[model samples]
Target: MPTLKTLQPGDEPLLEAFLWQHADTSMFLRSNCRAAGLLDEGARFQGTYVAAYINEAIVAVAAHFWNGMVIVQAPVHLAEVVQAAVTQSGRAIAGISGPAAQVEATKSVLGLSNRPTQLDESEILFSLTLADLQIPPALGAKQVQCRFPHSDELELLCEWCAAYNIEALGQKETSSLQPACRQIIEARQATSVHWVLVAENTLVSYSAFNAALPDIVQIGGVWTPPALRGKGYAKCVVAGSLLEARSHGVKRAILFTSDDKQAAQAVYRGIGFVPTGEKYGLVLFEG
Candidate 1:
């Protein structure tokens, strides 16, 4: 019989041990942060971390949080355990993010036919399996330049990210993200690298690639200035970042984008990133 228990800070090492055993080489974000973030007071988040054990040995773990959505992450074999955990939560809706097959399996087990509202379209996760994704030498004439962000680049990156949030969310700019962006910059973890792209000395776009695991890097926050849209700057920046990540010994580069964004999806495909499958994000509303 498998027993489930709540997670605590002391379980960080054990959690990492479990994740490393099953995660692909490309993921880098430490599981501890995921576990802790769900409980952080400043974020005003509430959640649960469950460790599934068979006798004295741990077989699986799941991190579920409550904040309008119950997000779950667990190993594939432990789907039954996750199902049991959700049944205990008594929440109407839940979200799960992981490998495409595992997510689908969980959905089937739950009988959750309700389509996802926010990230309804499959959050297509793409990856570059080859290391030789180099920029064509002939394209050098296009005047595309990439560089690591300088200390002075934060403000500009922040502004560009704010604009990205508004455009992506289809909402007016708000001050909420300012502090969160700052925290990400200040933390400066080894697994995270923030880059900015410049065209003729004007900041046009930015991208961030974070190590999700020892060998896996996840590309995120690819944003281009509104006025610069349709100029192909987004592709250039993404390609540059993907190349850089490959150079850093990343075996695979993964990224998630909404399926509805056909244009963005096209850009990624053009750069050699083929979709693996759907990544789900389930939302559980507050009662």
Candidate 2:
């Protein structure tokens, strides 16, 4: 069995090298680590980053966040090693998310009490290579109108995101969400931006390339106002986001959607995203 080691302060450099070995799949883990490194207040999360090793060579990596979000990327059999590290941390796990088979495999060892109270099981993961990207010319150019909003638009962005959390992620609005949204909007990453879709001066939809590596970008927080959905706006905005990514020289992009969201899946396919696989897990909350 490989030994599990918790990452320490200076271990980031080494840990990063391990993560980049599979950068496309490890985008979430890498993104979280990079954000924590940049944000002064990120220390509050103090979540555990653990890796399994054999004879000094790193074999697998898992990030268990302060918010109880555990994301793992490794062979399905290594799920036991991941379970041990997470259980030993004694932190309450709010959820586990990863590649479909791997997340389900990990749950078997994580124990029943730690299972998710609410689950977004069977999530379809999709990707868009440069060749796969298809932006409807008129929608991408005119109707969608996607771009990075200025600082003056922060308040409206926050409000839209708060509503997004409620409708998309099934969470209530709180004081912290707005400030967090503000921070993301203010972040000046060379390759990242919060792309919002505006129609007739009103913010209608939005998406973000929250995590970017040398060749891949991970899309998240995609939302269209409830009243605005089903009108094909999301498809346009998502395509625009990918085009924006192409402009930044990113070769490919990834996003995840629940299997139950057929309409959402249709939107992505319309823009030329192909489903790669499904991830299964419980967003377990600690009682």
Superposed model 1: Cα runs more than 4 Å off: 8-48, 55-59, 64-71, 75-121, 132-142, 169-172, 188-192, 282-287
Q: Per-residue alpha-carbon lDDT of model 1 for 116-140, expressed as tens digits?
A: 4333334777767746454633225
RMSD of every prediction: 5.1, 3.6
**Which portions of model 2 show Cα errors greater than 4 Å?**
8-24, 35-46, 76-80, 87-90, 112-116, 173-192, 278-287
Candidate 1: what lDDT?
0.59
Best by lDDT: 2
- Residue-level lDDT tens digits of model 2 in 43-131: 53345667787777677877667666777877633665577557656666667766666676666667644444534565777888966
